[model samples]
Target: MQAFSKVLRLVELLLIVFSVWSCTQERDADVGQADKRTVVSLHLGIKTQMSSGCSSCELVNKYQWNFLYRIFSGKEDIEFVVYCSDENKREVEQNLLYDVLILVDKSPETDELVVCHGRKTMFQKAGVLDMFSMRQITELLMDSALENEQPLRK
Candidate 1:
C-alpha cells in the first residue's frame, strides 16, 4: 500500500512538472510570435476640401475606404496615419503633390500607391482604389510585411 501511494505521488509530481513545462513552452512561443510581427504603416494624405469634388475626396467617403480602415484598424500589425491636407498644410506641401497619397511602411524604396485627380498609380501588385480588390490589398499588406522581415541587401 505504501509503494502504491509513493507511485501515485510520483505521478502527481510528474503531471505538475509537465503542466509547468507546457506553460513555459507556450509563453516562449508567444514571445517569438510577438518578435516576428511586422508593423505596416499606412500613411494617407487626404484632401479636406469637399467643394473641390475631386475623385480622391469622393473616394474617402466611399464605403471601400471606410471598410478597409475598419478591417485593418482591428489588426495587430497594421497602423494608419492620416494626414489631412487642410490640417497638415506643411506636410502636404512638402511631401505630396496630389489629392491623395497612400504610402505603405513609409518606405519610398518600396512601391507606393498615389491617387490624384481621377487617376491612380499602381504600387507593385496593388492597383488603384477603384480597381483594387480587398484580397489584393490584403496580399499586398502581407507581402509588404514579409518583405520587411528579410535582411536588407548590401
Candidate 2:
C-alpha cells in the first residue's frame, strides 16, 4: 500500500508540472500571433502622507486597470503598459525610461499629478484633473504619436 501511494503522489506531481507547461506554451503561442503595436508605457508611483492629529484617515485611490485595458485593447495603433511601483522618494529622482511617467501623490487632504514627456523626459505638474481620466490618457497618447510623427491606424 505504501509503495502504491508513493507512485500515485509522483504521478500527481508530474501532472501538475505538465499542466503548467502546457499553459505556458499556449500563452507563448498566443503572444506570437498577436498583432504588434506601438507601446505606451505609463510608469506610475504612489505617495502617502501621515497626519499627526486625526480622528480617522481615509484614502481614496481606487483606480481599476481592467477599465484602462479594455479602452486600449481594441485599438490596433496603440498599446499601453501601466507599471506601478511602491512609494519611494528616491524613485522620484531616478531617471526612468517610459512613454509617460506619472506620479500620483496624496497628501493629508489632496492629490497631485506630475507628468513627464516621452522624448525629452521632462516632468511637469499637471493641474488638469483630481485623478487621471481615460480622456487625458488618450490625449497624451495621441500627443506622443504626433511628437514621434507616427500615423494612427483607423
Candidate 3:
C-alpha cells in the first residue's frame, strides 16, 4: 500500500530532513545488464498527483510515448529514463514492478549508452522471462536517480 510519511516542517527540523533526503545515494539498476557502465539511483518515494493537471496529461503522455515509438519503431539506439507509475504501489515499493511509464529522459548517460537496443533486444529474444525492455527498465532507474539528484521541495 501507499504509505505517506507524516511530515512537520518546523524550520530547524525541516533543514535536517532536507539535508538527509538530498544526501542519500541513488538506486542501482536492478533489472538490466551488468556491463554497460554505471551510475546509481535510489527509490525515493511516492508522489501524489491530480488526475488532471494545469497541463493536459494526454498531451504530456503523447510527448513521452512518441519518443519511445521512435526508439523502438525506428530502431534508434538511445538511452534515457522513463518515469513509470502503476496502481500496484506495494509491488513497486518492494521493487517487484514492471509497469507502464509516464516520462522519458535524455541526460547524464546518453554518452555512456552506445549500443542502442542491442543488448536489451537480445535479452527479450532469449525469452529470459522478466520485465521486457531492459533499456526501458534502466530508464526507470534513471527516474529514481533523478529524485536523489534533484532538490525535493519547491
Candidate 4:
C-alpha cells in the first residue's frame, strides 16, 4: 500500500512538471511569433500624368518602378501593390487590403503623396519631391505598423 502511494505521488509530480513545461512552451511561442504586422500599399498612379508640375511624377520618371522594386520586393513582412490611373484617384482610395495607402498624384498638392492609415490621413507630403528618401518611407511604415500594434482603449 505504501509503495502504491509513493508511485502515485511520483506520477502527480511528473504531471506538475509537464504542466509547467507546457506553459513555458506556450509563452515562448507567443514571444517568437509576431502577432501584428504592418501592411503598406503604394499607388504609383503611373497612368495619370497631367504635366501639372507634380514632382512625384518627375521622380517616378527619373527613377522608375525598378527603383521601388529594388527596395521593397525582398521584404516578407510588407505587402506593396501598385495601380495605374489615367485620371481617377478613387481607385487607390477604395482599396481595403492595406493598413496604409500612399497616393502619388498631382492634385491635393503637387509633388506630394497622400498617406492614409485606415480612414485617417497620416501624411500629406511624402516621396522624392518632398526630399523623402526611400529609407524615410520605410521608417514611416515601421512607425505606422508599431502604432497599429497598440490596443485601443475604451
Name the best candidate (by lDDT). 4
lDDT of 2 by residue, 1-154 (tens): 9999688756645543443344234334445332233444343322335542431121222232334434444454454443343453234334332333333332212222222332222222222233445456556656655655656543
Which stretches in model 1 have alpha-carbon errors above 4 Å? 1-62, 87-128, 142-154
Compared with the true structure, all predictions reach lDDT values of 0.38, 0.39, 0.29, 0.40
Local accuracy of candidate 4 as per-residue lDDT tens digits, 1-154:
9999688756645543443344334334444333333233333423335664643443342342334335544444434444334443453344223333334332222123333333333443333433455555556655654565542221
- Provide the lowest-lDDT 10-residue window in model 4: 104-113
Clashes of each: 0, 0, 5, 0
- TM-score of every candidate: 0.32, 0.29, 0.22, 0.33
Segments in model 4 whose C-alpha atoms lie over 4 Å from true places: 1-35, 45-65, 86-130, 141-154
lDDT of 3 by residue, 13-47 (tens): 44333423332222134334333322221121223
Which candidate do you rate higher for TM-score, 1 or 4? 4
Report the alpha-carbon TM-score of model 4 versus the true structure. Answer: 0.33
Q: Which candidate is the best by TM-score?
A: 4
State the number of backbone clashes in model 2: 0
TM-score of candidate 3 against the unseen true structure: 0.22
lDDT of 1 at 125: 20
Q: How do all the candidates rank in terms of TM-score, highest first?
A: 4, 1, 2, 3
